[model samples]
Target: MIRGIRGASTIAYDNPELVMQETKNLMERIIRDNEVLPENVASVIISTTADIVSAFPAKAVRSLPKWEYVPVMCTHEMNVPNGLPLCIRVLVHVNTTVPQNEIKHIYLNEAVKLRPDLTK
Candidate 1:
């Protein structure tokens, strides 16, 4: 069966380097926490808050080892009043036998507040 794992992270500034690093960090956590292998990943959808325009998070993802062929897309998050700033979110679809309730989700930095119940 296919399952979706969610994750989010925040960057301190709009610097391109930071955006790339933070995005990589979030993806790594999501992959590790969920024990997801790249070959099993169906696709990854990434979104950044309006304030994050320095770079596409997918660029960072593509640079990772074994991630060159994983289908990935990036978009801008919907602007909402009082929404978290510099936040990047991702939904990763993967083929796995694990039950949906057992899948792990990752939320780092200030983005943890976005899903208080899921963050540990």
Candidate 2:
């Protein structure tokens, strides 16, 4: 079965390294929490708000050994007025044996404010 997992995080600055580290941390938690294997991940799509264009968050994620084989794509988030700034979001589509309701979604850092109910 194909299941979708979602995660979001915010960067402290436009620095590529910081964005990479936070994105890595967020993705690691999502994959680990859901017990998702790299091979099982069909695709991972990431988006950053308009204010963040220093680097593609997916590039950092793909650099990780655990995610080297996983397909990744990055894009710009919709430029809605008064939207969250410097945020990165991910949508992961995985071929998994787990049920949809069992999947764990993560929202970290300032992005946690986006969905307070989802964070631990």
Candidate 3:
């Protein structure tokens, strides 16, 4: 079976270092928590708030050891008048036997507020 795990993170500012760091942080948490192997990953879709333009979060995912071949794409999230700013979101599609309810969706930093219901 295949499942898509969702995650999001936020940076204090639009810096390349922050983008790379937080994006990698979020992905690592998802991978470790789900016990997902890079080989089982299909694709990852990443989006950042329009206010962020310093770097592509996909670059961070690609930099992960053993994840060089995972397909990843990056884009800007839709701009809403009162939407959260400086946020990065990701959807990772991977082959897994785990049930949907058991999957861990990571939301870090300020992005945690976006999905309070999913938190423990």
lDDT of 3: 0.95
lDDT rank order? 3, 1, 2
Task: For candidate 1, list the clashing residue pairs, or say none.
Answer: none
Model 1, range 1-120, lDDT digits (tens) per residue?
A: 999999999999898999999999999988888888999999999999999998989999999899999999999999999999999999999999999989899999999899999987
Query: What tens digits encode model 3's per-residue C-alpha lDDT throughout 18-114?
Result: 9999999999999999999999999999999999999989999999999989999999999999898999999999999999999999999999899
Writing each residue's lDDT as its tens digit, candidate 2 over 89-116 gives: 9999999888887789999988888778
Model 1 TM-score, all chains together? 0.97
Q: Which 10 consecutive positions of candidate 2 have the poorest summed lDDT?
A: 60-69
Q: Which one wins on lDDT?
A: 3
* Candidate 1 lDDT for residue 2: 94
> What stretches of model 3 exceed 4 Å from their correct place?
none
Give the backbone clash total of model 1.
0
Give the TM-score of each candidate. 0.97, 0.93, 0.98
Q: Which ten residues in a row have the lowest lDDT in candidate 3?
A: 111-120
Regions of candidate 2 where Cα sits further than 4 Å from its true position: none
Whole-model alpha-carbon lDDT for candidate 2? 0.88
